[model samples]
Target: MFTLFRKEINGYLSSLVAYITIGVFLLVMGLFLWVFPESSILDYGYATMEGLFNTAPYIFMFMIPALTMRTLSEEQKDGTFELLATRPLTDWQIVWGKYFACLLIVLLALLPTLIYYYAVYKLGATEGNIDTGAVIGSYIGLFLLGGAFVAIGLFASSVTKNQIIAFAIGVFLCFFTFIGFDSLSQLLSFRTIDSFIASLGINEHYQSVSRGVLDTRDLVYFLSFIGAFLVVTKTVLGGRKW
Candidate 1:
């Protein structure tokens, strides 16, 4: 598993995918947070990093699929998946190894965003005026959200040998999980049912954690979401034997 993990990371680095992924994420976020006049912090007249926390998930919706689309799909397309399957590693190991590698790249991209937090912290009307707890919670929520997207993308890749197809399907699935459920819930008139349905969506849980509450249910939801997709990916890989 560790070997596969290293190989996956090395493969991404070898092709400049890691650099591109991090660069694109930073570029987009930087434009919205600092460069643009309307959304820029300097124009907001407030020292909050709220824009970043709000915008990042949408950015991640696309960024994660772009990163993970080729993970298994390209290998399958090029017949390398067969070679990987023949290795001593189990399907779970292979899935997890790839999953972690993708997740690690996402975390690396996010690391530089901490500087935004530091800047906001210092630039506030009073030093340390920013809500540190909320910032931390939002960062955690963003990581888990990215992990969920990676798992979904891995599953999408496992189902097809075409990277483009994998990316499209992964993006659709991620979008549905992130917002579709919440949209559906809004159609219901009953408050109880509406809230329950909304709770099933990623946005609800993400918002909960982003508020700095650290609720265990939100954690479980993210873990289970990632686990469910990963299990499906493993099953797909296992079924390739037929």
Candidate 2:
């Protein structure tokens, strides 16, 4: 597992993929937090990172899929997976190895955004006026949320050999998982179970955690959701016997 992990990480770092992914993510974030009028901190005139927190998940919904689209898809397409699978690695190792590598890239992408936080921290009328707890909680929520999307993206990649198709599948699945259930809860037909239905989606748990509450229920939901998708990805890899 560690070998596969290192290899995958090296693959990303050795190429332009890691740098490009981080650059694009940070670029879009910079645009939203600084350049864009509506979400720009300059326009808000507050130390709060509500703009960053509120819009990050949506950015992640697309960014992660683009990163993971080639994880398994490229391997499968290039016939490299056959050789890798022939080695002693288990399917879980392969899945996790690639998963963590992609996740590391995501974290690296997020690392630069701390500049925005610091800028906001000092930009306020009072130094450090920003809500530290909420910022920390939102960062945690974003990490877990990104993890869930990585798992979903891996599953999407596992199901196909075409990177474009994998990317599309990943984005669609992430969007639906993040917001579809919440939307479904509003339907008149599901009024009785609306809350319960909403609770099933990432948005509900994500919103709960973003409030700086650190609820165990929300944490469990993210972990369970990630685990379930990774397992499904392993199953998909297992099914491809050769």
Candidate 3:
């Protein structure tokens, strides 16, 4: 498992995927936070990071798919997945190794965003006037969100040998888990249980955490959400034999 994890990390670095992923994420986030007037923090005249937290998930919907699209699909397509299976590693080890490698890539992409936080922290009417609690909570929520998305993407890749197909499936699944339930809950037909339905999606818990309150329920939801997808991914990966 460790060897596979290291190989996956090395594969991403040698292929420049990690650098490009980080660069593209920062570029798009910078534009939304600075250049785009509508979403720009400068135009808000406040020391808040509402735009960053709100905008990141949508960007991640696309960006994370692009990053994880090849994690397993490329291996399957190139006939390397067979090599991986013949090794001593178990199915769970393979799934986790790939999952962690992809998650670390996402963490690298998010690290530089702290500069934005610091800038907002200083740009306030008073230095460090920002909502420190909220900022920290939002960051935590975003990381959990990324972890869930990576699991979803890995599952998507596991079921397909084509990277493009994997990406499409990943994006759709991410959208469905993240916001599709919330949208479905808003339907007139579902009005009676709308709130309950909304609770099934990631956005509800994500927003709750973003509000600077770390509810154990929200933490449990994220953990369960991520774990469910990863377990399913392992199931899918193991199913290749039968």
Maximum-lDDT candidate: 3
**Please, what are the lDDT tens digits per residue for candidate 1 over residues 1-242?**
99999999999889889999899999999888998786798898877777888889889889999999999989988988888888899988999899999999999999998888888888888888877899899999999999999999999988988899999999999999999999999999999999999999999999999999999999999999999999999988888863
Candidate 3 runs further than 4 Å off: 189-192
lDDT of 2 by residue, 100-208 (tens): 9888888888888998898888878989998899889899999999999999999999999999999999999999999999888888475669988988999988888
The true-structure Cα RMSD of candidate 3 reads 1.3
Per-prediction TM-score to the true structure, in the order listed:
0.97, 0.97, 0.97
Clashing pairs in 2: none
Go through the candidates in order and give each one's C-alpha lDDT: 0.91, 0.91, 0.92
By summed lDDT, which 10 consecutive residues of candidate 2 come out lowest?
Answer: 183-192
Error of 3 at 93 (Å): 0.1
Error of 3 at 37 (Å): 0.9
Clashes of 2: 0
Clash pairs, model 1 backbone: none
58 Cα displacement, candidate 3 (Å): 0.4
**Residue 127, candidate 3: how far off, in angstroms?**
1.0
